[model samples]
Target: MDLDQLRTFDRIVREQSFTKAAAYLNITQATASMRIRALEQLLGVTLFQRGRTVTLTDQGMTFLPFARRIIGTVQEGREALRRVERGRIAIASLRSLVSPLITEPLLRFQQHYPGVDVVVNEGRQAQIVAMLHERDVEMGILCWPNIDPLLVDLVPLVIMRERVPLVVAPEIAARLPARPSIEEVLALVPRVISLRWWQAEPETAAALVRLAKTSVELPTGPARRLAIKGEGLGFFVNSAVADDIEAGRLVEIAPPDFEALHRDTAMVVRSLAALDRDMLADFIAEIARECAKVGIILDNRLASLGDKVA
Candidate 1:
């Protein structure tokens, strides 16, 4: 009936665990159960069927969207008031990619709307998802494949794709042949600089894992630094090291039959309703405009979302 009750219901469904939902809400499990019970009683319908694993009943499925809308409506009202009183907006993205990707867009947004305060947060995919679901951030810019619909209804806007080149230190490249096989590349790069969490997709992550004998996994910033210092052979997104490769600091070590490695990025919102606001719409536009400067255009994948587009 109330916002708190609706939030508990929503989080329970998303997390699929009463214990996790309770912990996330900073409430006791018993209290969470009681709230759900009270809500079901008020509605005269059993929301979730009790079982070893909680599954939403027919009633719950029908009510889910309405509950989400209610919570989103409340959050939107708060955001509007915050704009007037605090002049603030929150955005999140990867720390390393933000500079090459969104820095120009954000700068232009600031120039045109200097009065609006923009708070930026940087983290891995899981962290970003948490922030989005909690309404801690109004927008997120990250790899498109990393967005999971169950966590949040993302309004994905693919801005660019970069080839994932296999590279080594310039000195190492000189000693190696013009092209190497997968096995040779793996053997040469004993300590491959792999990203532990921020992969383009699950299949890509699995492929990389199988290729590396001894991997040195790190987050975006540290991974780039280690790769640059020639600790070992590395595979990286082209944008992350395009300058280094151009300057001859890094060399591409391609396999004879290596497929081009392309990763796509998108601008996302928690829900389509989240994008209905003018501020968010403008921000999305700014991202597209800035990406155009770098020759990245809005992708058809985003265009296919139909009415989800703002």
Candidate 2:
């Protein structure tokens, strides 16, 4: 019924344990229990099933999203007030994109606006989206195809397309032809280290699964490392493996039959009117500039903004 009750319920759902949630919230276990009991009594439904591990009941599952929205709304209001009091920017980004996409722009932004506080939270796609919706972050940078502006309520400010090339250790590359067929590459090195960096073309994703003798999904960092260690061939963004390729640590394989692979990463904001317009525009320009330095192409829509802020 109250904010404390809603927060307690949300924390319990996330922690999946009353004791753990209570500890996190810095409240006694009895107080946490009492809050939940009061909430359930007011709602007239059993929210959680009593057990060693907390499990949400049907009613609890139904109410969870609403409860989270309420909590997020309150938090958002607090963040808005804080922003007004001082210059602060919070961003959520995909883990894989942090080094390749965010780092340079962030460093540049800081140099220019030393007084403004910037925070970057890295997570998977869903987690980043959640952070944006919850107003835990003002912006999000992530790969595209799953984002729907209408559905997620996040507006795309800029989108960058980067080429993803199949790379392998130099030793493995030495055994293959200049323009080998995918089957030939597979024959030479049966293992494929897959990183779902983007929503790859369905046919390409399926074909890799069908043809590779051994396929293992890994995060971008580990997959790139494994490819460098000669464990398997990996498809990595050009920026991610550029240094390695230049140093002869890895070789890019261009298969005649394989479609060119690329990933689209976008910078999105929940509401532009709610943000510091000049600051946001300046940061977007910095991102575009960094992308260009590494051969990532920005969307046509951002060209005008780039020019204005460049």
Candidate 3:
């Protein structure tokens, strides 16, 4: 019921092992177990199925978002007070979306507002959305199609569309048909390492599960790393791996009906009325400029890939 118990529970779920979670939180394993037991007794339902490897029960999955919100609330309050005192700005974003999207603009912002303090919190979209709803962050940069209106009324700015293509190492690409169908391509790839966020979509999630035998879920960075090694096929945004594609380290594989996937990237503020209007607008403008640059780079990369295909 207390913050400590909640923190322990969250860490345990993340680490998926009592011992590792305890180490992460700098507590003993017994203490971690005790906290989960206490929390379960208070909730009147078992949160996790205790076994060799910890797995969340149905109840745990239902409670996870609420638990995150509770922690986010406290952190947000502290951040609000910090902002009032020291002119701080907080941003929440997915781990993969941070680079090239927020990094350039953030660095520019720091140089422009040298007096203001910036705090960056990176997590999955769910966690980032919770932080935004709880007011833990002043602004957030996230990819589109994953936005939940129930979480927060997203006031999006600078919506940029970037192409995401299925890519593989040159050797793997060489083995694929000149222009394979979606089913053929899916069948040919020995493994499909999908990013978790992409799997969040209901249709994609179901399709991925259908290929569960050969698919593995990973975060963006690891998925790209594995793809570069030709370990498996990976679907990634052009901006993230344009250099690799251009340098021939990775090859874009276009299916007969590839559908040309594009994701919307946005810069959003918590609320138009709640924050400093001018400051938010200025930051949005800066972020938009950087996003434009990214779009240009992605377009160029895709064009190069097209030239190769032709």
lDDT of each: 0.73, 0.79, 0.72
TM-score between candidate 1 and the true structure? 0.74
Q: How many angstroms is residue 278 displaced in model 1 relative to the true structure, after the best TM-score fit?
A: 6.8
**What value does the lDDT take at residue 297 in candidate 2?**
62
What's model 3's lDDT at 191? 80
**Candidate 2 C-alpha error for residue 103, in Å:** 2.2
Q: What TM-score against the true fold does each predicted structure earn?
A: 0.74, 0.81, 0.67
| Candidates ranked by lDDT | 2, 1, 3
User: What is the overall TM-score of model 2 with all chains considered together?
Assistant: 0.81
Poorest lDDT segment (10 consecutive residues) of candidate 1: 196-205
Question: Candidate 2: which pairs clash?
Answer: none
Candidate 2 C-alpha error for residue 214, in Å: 2.1
Off by over 4 Å in 3: 1-77, 145-152, 182-188, 199-213, 274-280, 296-310
**Model 1 residue 225 lDDT score:** 71
Q: Listing every candidate in turn, what is its Cα RMSD in Å to the true structure after a full C-alpha superposition? A: 4.9, 4.0, 8.6
What does the lDDT read for residue 81 in candidate 2? 91
Kindly list the per-residue Cα lDDT of model 3 for residues 182-286, writing each as its tens digit: 676666567887775542443543464466358788877788888888777766777788888999989998776545566666666655553343455555556
The total of clashing pairs for model 1 equals 1
* Candidate 1 Cα outliers beyond 4 Å, as residue runs: 28-31, 44-46, 49-52, 94-96, 122-139, 145-147, 150-158, 191-193, 196-205, 229-234, 243-249, 268-286, 293-295, 298-310
